[model samples]
Target chain A: MKRNPIGVLLALIAALALLASACGSDDGADSADEVDSGDTAESTSAESSASAGPLRVGIVAPSASNDLAFTQSIVDAVNAVAGDRELDIAVTDGTFIVEDAAAAIRGYAADGVDLVIAHGSQYGGPLQEIAPDFPDTAFAWGTAVDTFGLPNVAAYTVRADQGGYVNGTLAAQLSESGVLGVVGPIEVGDAKLYVDGFVAGAKAQDPNVTVNVNYIESFSDVALASEAATAHIQNGADVLTGTAQMVVGATGVAGPAGALWFGTQSNQTPLGPDFVVASQVYHWEVVLSEMMAEIDAGTFGGEVYTLTLENGGLVIEFNDGAGADSSVIDGAQATIDGIIDGSITTSDG
Target chain B: MWSDFFTTSVIVATLASAVRFATPFLLAALGEAVGQRSGVLNLGVEGVMLCGAFTAYYVRLNPSGWGWAGGMATAILAALAVGLCMGLLYAWMTLVMHAEQGISGIGIFLFGLGATDLLFQKQVGVPLPISGLRPIRIPLLGDIPHVGDILFNHNVLVYLAYVLVPVITLMVNRTTFGLNIRAVGETPEAADTLGVNVNLIRLGAILIGNALAALAGAALVMNTNIFQQNLTAGQGFIAVALVYFGAWRPGGVMAGALLFGLVSSTVLQLKTLGIVSGAASALTAMAPALLTIVVLVIVSRRIGQPSALTRPFDRNA
Candidate 1:
């Protein structure tokens, strides 16, 4: 049967639009909700008070809460910071779509949460728009410095390089091939900062060591990340370090090849015990707790919080399962102390 | 750094990576070629791939009581079944319901991506590792140094993808079914008048195409033993593009897949060897797609697409 081409095309477009809307954001929330610490509608008294009651905190992240990459870093930190202070935490993760994330941010702010952490750089713009409407609620977003200069918004940025440098220094020691590899997502924001710092520290540790870096240009292309790591291994790279969630792919290849893996953003020890020597864990709690304290002291958001080694915001967590020698641990600690003090200098780029 | 990239070892490693990379593309693009040959455009190849990859990974994560072989077989079958179901849906939309092929295919892709992500979240809350298939060394052939590693040291599915190219070529070129498909795709009115079932041929082609695409997704997830949302990435769409780049021939499709694989691998290798950096590496990464687009431009004028592609054929009309 010959159908009218134009009519069929119009009908398909209409059906697709409806289907697309139905399938898109609702699934994003359902997936993220599974990873949430608290049910979406559970504990809410329109007054978010950190001093008098448990601090009500809500998080909107771009990927899964346990992605073991960017999103996990903040989620882990928030959970950690809940110590001593009873914190009511809710998370809407896997909101990689900016618009969906924006909606989630607005919802949290409207709920009168004490702090709404938009845990993605892309959410910066959305936070900017949503913060002014909820002037009483403090909004924090990052790996970015921009707070839109809003009185009700705070910014948190990480010196991921502080940890990346330490990771690279350790990588240089663990590598027998003297050739290290990096599987990067995209060379922008924290990913780039981490890679640059890794290279600087590795080159500083062993000037002749070769660190081959491959930016697969995608954060979730696990297959490509695997191939990149394979290429590195095939070419004699015995130590691999990478950023972003896709490093799970790299870690998978590294374990079987007997190559040591160094991680960042979150403690990737759970990725595998065999390959993960150490990780540069982002302890956002240090910065976050400070922000919460400031808010409790009647200061709304006029400051930028930076996570640094000195501030105890970022720490090199040695995977005891990998079982590194004392010398390796001592060297990493020394590098950390140096970066913390004035001795060790890192490339900020 | 430049000298390191030019070494024979690096070259061999790059080629090996390229071959591994090409496996998924070949599986998907070859299936797409078959579907296009039958005058149907299944743009949802990517979506089907996502569903397939997730199904395979989820199944692989939960090992059945029947050991490694059984678990592996079950996962593969499950993924293939999902593909078949998706294909049936695509066929029903285009063939029975007479929906516009392009738009409906996209809808399928979006649905697959979203649905798999939802299933993954509900079934497996976090990304966990599984024991994926390991590379098998062919008896004597695997003993050869670099050449053996490149060709013989591959998983079963990798070998299957390469083997299917010729089998499909033979089926499409030599069989009566192939002839009927070509006739229906090219001259559906005459084929229908002569008692050929156009819809049946198209349906078969779509089902076969979708199954292969699903296998491609399965191969990707099995390689890593890890499943995330959109694990197949944009490989499905790339496979569709490769069909056109190959002028809809299975041989040409294989070449296109291999070419893309090599270029991508080579670019990655260059960066890995420290011979390329920064924006230059980014630009070089686009080589495969650029090369494909150039071929497409040349083929558009010289070659022919299936005459009745995307058009719903009605016997009454």
Candidate 2:
């Protein structure tokens, strides 16, 4: 009976090992991809400063970083900055619950991690609430609007509209129906601007073309996005675009169903090879690398930094760069170059 | 007012909302059915559901790019394993150690919630954007006029929930294992004396029940196409109340679920129509739980649960 108990314990441990093995593939793939990013990794190390004891930092997000289209860019930027430094960078999943975010922030703060990059806008409120208690710690949230002015805090934002305008032009030119769809995230001020730019750009390309818009009221709900996309599909909209964090759900529906899609934030072409015509890509690596350089130089301070088209903060990723077809890239780049050179205007004004 | 409320969009929205609301409840209620039938009242359904949803989302999105099927299969499998382990642990605590079932179940719920959130923090490192399960419209039935469009045009889990209702009903009525489960709940000592292994049966039921609860979590995340922290909210507890309204029968549980789904859909549609104020809309969202409470109070006279629920059985007795 005692031997049986030992056997049962071993079986339980074995089962758990099998379960962990099953779970590791996704994470392991991330590491493998990092290895493939050899040049980028080397560049990161070369950039690290010797003066700073490779600042140990932790980042928390409200969701997992798998949507290569938007969230992955931010993650890549952070990881690049960390890998270059001799820093112990810890990243905890925020999972988007208020309580969980609070707990994770407090845990990291307790561990004396020099900086906690609360990346999601949702994390701003929680970090603000927790920040006062942990006075020694510094926080750098992603969105500008959420960061309250404090000695220990900084916020960074990008002019997403700059890229949105260029992609909107591509959507207009490529659409067979001359009707484009813009799926915004919850009607927030920033999302509204992105949608507004897309609409203005589409109409700028062809005054006769109509742009229909919908907002899902949250950044991460892909199912609702799909539902909204379905309605637009039913309404004869041929080119779909969204400002939400997860465009895959909308693009996933639009791609197989024969409607072309323009994506936002990160590169999303892999989600639907044929359907994802192009995306307004946000490269987090450059921004993080720039920021970390300042931080290592001992000149970093609490302030808001907003990047725009002029600084190469945002770029229109033609399907070509994403291993997409040549015909698509050439046509899209015509609009993209026009926007860059000041020949095309995507604004309503 | 009428145009906004009765438009084709509103009708489609309402049907979509019903499917969205029905999925988690159906999954949790099915789990509760198994737990209750084994004389163990597991109230930890909510915790198990949350953990499953979080873990499932993480499994789906890790970049080695497990395709859609692989992603979904991982979630289901992860949920099942977690459910099984939690169930076994709960059984050992409540059944073997003879702890209070209600308290132990609540502990399990709390543990599941915190543990899952922590594990997610360590593993996922950011919020995961798992693709929601796509709706697979059935062949001819999916093309059928009005009903087919409304009912069949939903993700796979919603259909699975619908099928489980009758399947479970039939299982409870027809199968020998089901008979033993029912017998164990009613009078464990008598069943034990009659040569049934009450411990084994109860443990089996708990594991099965937890699995169903995990399924509820998976269904919500997969069908909704996203996993939010505290995603299940109070759906698990509502599922427990539904068991009473359902009189512990699968048919009754499904009817109760349908009513809850309908009420939720109506409220959401009302919000979209702008008929309800923002404050009122918030209140309207609570309609399902309030209705569940009202149903329990009204239906208590007609329904009686097993006499020995929550009491651990001893063969020596």
Candidate 3:
């Protein structure tokens, strides 16, 4: 018998394909069983107020939960909320592709979890499609305002501009070059809003200061982001800021250039300890707690929640290790106060 | 938009940016050109690049405190080693095992993507910054008006790419080894009859191509000074396509890369200058890829790919 290598290769490929499909289905079935057990536990624990079973929260995000950017901000907030309560968290992260995210979202809903968070603006279309199907299971999503007017859906967004304003204020005050660079992911949602506020705040500080904004038009193109930052630095931007996971690339450039960096979504101090001046940390718990309360009170959805500076959902965390002057911190606090008191508007003029 | 983009300062800046952007593409495409010229189409260049980028990032992150230049050299060497290893695996699967080149390449790609992401998550839990190689300006040349800033002022890798383009052109077209590569790629059986070891030459070509592809990845990460999951994006695939776009010639590939780099940098500059409105970003973002397709279609008529580009060679046949 002659050994046919091609035949063996074909068989190996087929076997691997089958194995992949099997593993995918296995994950689906495992989640279904977990949901089934969760439903049973929920019903049993409903009667016991003195000892509540863990409140299961499922999250589907666009990137890793520890990305130190957009997704991590919410994950950190959720963890903080869970610290004082009995909670079980299930996360399906790195779902940048909408189809994968949709499957994960539906899987979590089928699991009969108390709350399912779809944590990306891109997930809105899929959530709108999936939310009505799960009327009993509360669904929350955003960086968007449209709840699709669905009864079982809640929409939450951050006034990221508020924090962006504070960051820009400090960035302007600390800039010796009087030029700031903004490396934005895409010109939409929170990223765009943050850039607009940042530019506005920078101009408000000193009308003559130049603020260069570059939207690399990608959420995960780290290389492009770095190039954009390099271009910015070459063009004389002494201070920089960016939003999304790709900002890691921008910060990488800025840090080495000794340029002050303002970050959004999560604390980016770890990425650039000596260069990261501050971060606009998103504290989603301010809104998440409210959504959880509403769900517990028998309201399935149909409300929009916004994270604002006044509500303490967005906080400007200054990096003390970055050698930021107290004057800059004071100015940042003043800007925050102004925004909260409606004395300063983050809106572009 | 044209008015702003046409300024002297903007033109020089855009050119400089283009050179920086084109380095990785040029390196990878030139590598793929060599491999394709030798009758192999390793679509796994993208995967190989990802592995290289990760290796380089990891090396830079956990440096031997070998100073900046020393650390960069170490990272580049490690990336090349990884690329060579991947090339060997690809060669074995496609050449020895007689696996389908397309599927095997895809398999390599998937393996690289998943393995790199997993290892990165496990070892480096979060993205960290490294002091990447900075641009080194050639004193006299860098001082030469606009030309100096655009062409002479770049990182060492970019300069290497500048030299590699012409050197590879010479190696591929004007050398005896080049003739053997063309002969094996065109007619392996005839080459074998002439006493050339087809398999040995193919293996060598694959290894060299992969090493270059790995260097492309290293250059990308080092240029950026940071690494993230899927950091190469689809640049590797673009690099592969560029070989065809370049007509398998080093010069043509460099030209294609520069075109892409310039277009991309211009779009970014336009977007930054607020000359291109936000509403037009989606269209502008597609500009580089769309232009590549148009160029490829135009060039396809006159230039032909290597005859046996993806055909597996089996001595038994």
Candidate 4:
């Protein structure tokens, strides 16, 4: 009876993995926990500028922290706000299920964190049910303006259309084919706002430019998104934009096709530096900082915060490397200024 | 308006997308056709695809600083390894444990969904892009106009998928193993009487089915040049349908896959040209599923299903 060499090799590798874990220190184990991210793993990192006085925070999101879409927007904002401050951050991401998010939110509250951001609109129902149970713990949820009449809950909403207009203005001028396309997830919610605003802005810039919009009616159907982008490209659309996470698939198609892409929810420059013209980045730090100040002043909630360009909650992140002409950049800034000063209005549906 | 919508460029683009869309379905369904012919109703094809897709993408992400060939080889091997492991587990559950096939299959799907998503978040942490297998144009043939662009300009996986149709057809219809498979599927008792190893044949079929399902995932991830949770996004379940509607015949499965791709791409083209809009567009999204159901219902009645599908084999009984 001959023992297989491959089996022997597998057993040896398993033994080594166990040995490595056994040899690691408590701090190493703690750091490993931070990287062990997901729905179940509450990545609690103990490091802070100050050991005892750092602001304690926890995040419960519906998707991965690095989704480069909705969740990434809040996570990046929180990181920016916590900069140079002794802040302790823990993330329990990929809680797409409502029940899972509710549990994580309660868990963060039970752990007595100073701030717990429940980062999904779907989680709104659960937070409404859970917030009363832990009144002292500050909790926030978004894409909605209602704070559930709860004193301790903070509600944040984004004027994605604000940045959508800026993106639209630039795309209309930049498109060589006089055509633009938008692949929206659904015909409602924040995605609708962005798409509608984009079409409006494109029309405002050039009335003759054909702006096509396709609401595929799904948030995660990547294949359909790809097909929609391809369809738009075939129809002479040189500019493309889509909302929701599934646009990851559309970006892949658009990049190879040399189509200019305008992004929203988060900065998507990293997806394709050469083609992603700009992103309507949500800077939640504007609201989060104000919330922190209110918390320090012994005020917990009772306010609905809207992320507006006027308040610096939304920013049009232009990729200088993508090389838009100075006139286009200047035109974009002028549009932003007009919107901020009430000279321009994003027609809301 | 009609003339604008029926342009040559638009038709060519739609056909090309149909080919790309059909590649994964064709791969998974062909393997599924083989297994179904042997009477194994393994509905865990989608789950196995996720494991394969994730493994292939993760391996290719870093590339181990290897050259193009080395990186591609490594990624493909990793995907195959994951597929083989998933197949063995599924085979054990249905064969050794004699678990209810449909329920166990669903269990596999759910596990793949949760596990792959969790593993991705834990391991990758971010959606980092990878340049997967690139398209290799077929020299002089690729220089031909519309036909060549639509047919000869796809990646190697697309070529492999089309090539395997006849190979699978022959294996299922021409060989001694094929005879044994048909006997077991139709009448296991008679196959046993004839000294056929029913379980071994079934196991071999299951392995081939799952490995091909995995390859379908790899093809998808490679073509997309990216990975996401549930990246296959119901394509696996659709692949399983392709097998059933295709009547356990490789050629039929290929036709079913192509039909689905064509319907989907054509509707997209219509929507883009503004021929479909408002309520019509919403309804158009359901066109592919409706067509698939219609075809499956009509085709299945005409060709019929396997005699012993989803039936567990026990020689003593």
Give the alpha-carbon lDDT of every model. Answer: 0.84, 0.69, 0.85, 0.81
Candidate 3 per-residue lDDT, tens place, A190-281, comes to: 99889988988889888889998888889999988988887788777899999999899888889888899999999999998888989999
Candidate 3 residue A136 C-alpha distance from true site, Å: 2.3
- At residue A11, candidate 3 shows an lDDT of 70
Assess the local accuracy of residue B227 in candidate 1 as a C-alpha lDDT between 0 and 100: 84
Q: Give model 2's TM-score versus the native structure.
A: 0.72
lDDT score at residue A301, model 4, on the 0-100 scale: 82
Query: Between candidates 2 and 3, which one is better according to DockQ?
Result: 3
Q: Model 3 residue A118 lDDT?
A: 91
Question: Which clashing pairs does model 4 show?
Answer: none
Q: Ranking by lDDT, best first? A: 3, 1, 4, 2
Candidate 2, residue B296: how far the Cα is off, in Å: 6.9
Q: Could you tell me the lDDT of residue B131 within candidate 1? A: 76
**Most DockQ-accurate candidate:** 1
For A87-197, candidate 2 gives per-residue lDDT tens digits of 455555434566766777777888887777777666777777887777777777776654576766778787676677777777777788887777666554446657777
- Which candidate's TM-score is highest? 3
Docking quality category of candidate 2 according to DockQ thresholds: incorrect
Put down candidate 2 lDDT per residue, B1-317, tens digits, no spaces.
Answer: 65766767567657656665677787789879877987999988887887777767767766256565466677778877887888888788767766677867776676666666446544654443455577788889988776677888877778888898888887777988888889999998889889999888888889888888888888767754555445565778888988888899888888888788778667545544446643554576567678888889999988778877998887664
lDDT of 3 by residue, B160-218 (tens): 98899889888878998888899899999889899888888899899989999899999
**TM-score of each candidate?**
0.91, 0.72, 0.93, 0.86
Worst 10 residues of 4 chain A by lDDT: A20-29
Error of 1 at A277 (Å): 1.3
Pitting candidate 2 against candidate 4, the one with the higher lDDT is 4
